[model samples]
Every structure is written in C-alpha cells, then in structure tokens.
Target: MPALTVLTGAATAAYSAALVARPQLLQRPAGLARNRDARTLTRLVGVRDTAIGLAMVLAPAGPARRAAVGARVASDWGDAAVLGVALRGRGTWGKTVGFAALWGAVCLAALRYDER
Candidate 1:
C-alpha cells in the first residue's frame, strides 16, 4: 500500500508538470490569439493540478488526506476529459468506459491508505 501510494504520488507530480507546461507553450503560439481570461483560466487549472500533485507526494498524511486523495482524483479527471474530447459524443461512451477503469485504479490507490 505504501509503495502504491508513493508510486501514484510520484507519477501524479510528473503528470502535473506536463499539464502545467502545455498551456505555457500555447501562450506563445495560438494562445496569442486566445482570449486573455480563457488563457489565464487554463494556466490556473494547470497550476492547481501541479500543486495538488506536489502536495500528494510531499505531504500524504496528517491534518488532511484530502490533498493526496484529490491528487489521484485530479489525474483521473484529466484522463477522462482527454478521452471525452478525443472521442466526442458518438464515440464518447467508449471513452466513459475507459474513464471508469482509470477511476477504479485511482480508487484502489486511495483505498489502500484510506484508514478513515
């Protein structure tokens, strides 16, 4: 369980670093044409994801397991979103199944340390 938690946390942090980078990359390209508020919002989302990821790895317990729990949940959330966008409506149902599987994996990691 501890190993699972550490592995997930490390992976989560790495994922977030990528998430944060994508928007910054866009800010120079097509992002130059995008609405300022929308761009800011996108960057904020990435920052939030990155923080949650770092938190999970650095502080996994005490006061609140919420951050750690949320870290994995956030990763799963992004996975589902990507799958949804990639597939669109007619094919989205398959993406949903994939999301469910991903969620299940996250849940297993969460449950492993969910002493509460």
Candidate 2:
C-alpha cells in the first residue's frame, strides 16, 4: 500500500512538472485555447498538483499521509467536474473527464490500505 501511494505520488509529481514546464501539453490536448491566461491557469494547477503529490510522498504513514492522499483524490474529482463542464461538446471532453474520474477512483481506493 505504501508502495502504491509512493508510485502514485511520483507519477503525479512528474506529470505536474511537465505541465508546469509546458502548458501546451495540457492545452493542446484539452482543446483549450492557447493563450497567456490559459497557460497561467495550467501552471497554477501544476503547482497545486506538485504540492499535493509531495505531501503524499513525504508525509509519514498514518493520518497525515492519509489526508494527503485524500487531498489528491479530491483534487482529481474537482478537476473532473470543472473540466467536464468546460470541455463539454469538445472532442477531448471524454478523455479528460474520464482520466480525471478514473484517477480519482484509483486514489480513493488506495485509502483502503492507508495505515491509519
């Protein structure tokens, strides 16, 4: 379970880094307009993800770690809701929403094994 948590965190952190470094990675695929505002928003989301991922990875086993994982799960769900509405009728809507919801589920399931 710890290993699973660590792996998930690492993956999130890496993806966040990529998003921060290249906003186009998310913008182009999500069919969002490529503009300064979009890039800024994307990078902000990246920063948020990075912080949450690091918290999950670095927090010790127990409630603190569990909370961190919970945050990640919550964040994903929020993303799904926001993106689902924003991307409605777009080609990338399904892909974006599906990924967010699925990832949120995965993170939520991991809570079962959290050493509380």
Candidate 3:
C-alpha cells in the first residue's frame, strides 16, 4: 500500500505537469487561438498550472500540496492509459513529452520526502 502511495504520488505529479504543459503546446494552434473564449480559458489554465507548479516547488505541505499529490497520481494513470493503448500487442508510438515531464517533477518532489 505504501508503494502504491508513492506510485500514486508520482502519477499525480506527472499529470499536473502535463496539464501545465498542454497549454503552451496549444497556444500556437491557429484554430484554438481564434476563439476568444477558448483563448481566455487556455490562458487561465496556463496561469493556474503555472501557479500550481510554483506552489509545489515552493512548499509541499501547503494548501497546494493536495493538488500536487493528485497530479502525481493522475499522471501515472494517464501514462498507463497511453502505454496500454499504444503498446498492447500493437505497434504504435509511445512517444510523448507530457508524461515524461510530469514524472520528472515527481522525482523532484520525492527529493524532499522524509521517508519516515
């Protein structure tokens, strides 16, 4: 169960990073930027993610900690879904930066764990 807790933590961090990066990736899309509402929402999401990442980086046990924790868990889940879809007895590209980046953040956060 404790192992699962760490796995979930990593997944949550990855997912949150993915959420943060998705906006920067879509910012250049012509169709997406055309709609004012879409643009506004995207910007807001970017801001939110940036804020969350900053918060996670700043303090772990603060209010944002729960979100940071969730992001870690969700990220592993998303990656698993991607891998299952792309590698289940079928040849497909399992290439993407989102999950990798999130996993990286998980490692960063884990550095501060007391393991007590």
The per-model lDDT (C-alpha) reads 0.56, 0.86, 0.47
Order of candidate numbers by TM-score, starting with the best: 2, 1, 3
Q: How close is candidate 2 to the true structure, as a TM-score?
A: 0.92
Per-candidate count of clashing residue pairs (backbone under 3 Å): 0, 0, 11
The ten-residue window of minimal lDDT in model 2 covers 107-116
TM-score of 3: 0.37
Candidate ranking (lDDT, best to worst):
2, 1, 3
Best lDDT goes to which candidate?
2
Task: Return whichever of 2 and 3 wins on lDDT.
Answer: 2
Worst lDDT window (10 residues) for model 1? 24-33
* Model 1: residue 51 alpha-carbon error in angstroms: 0.9
Is candidate 1 or 2 superior in lDDT? 2
After TM-score superposition, the amount by which residue 60's alpha carbon in candidate 2 deviates from its true location, in angstroms, is 0.8
Residue 61 local lDDT, model 3: 55
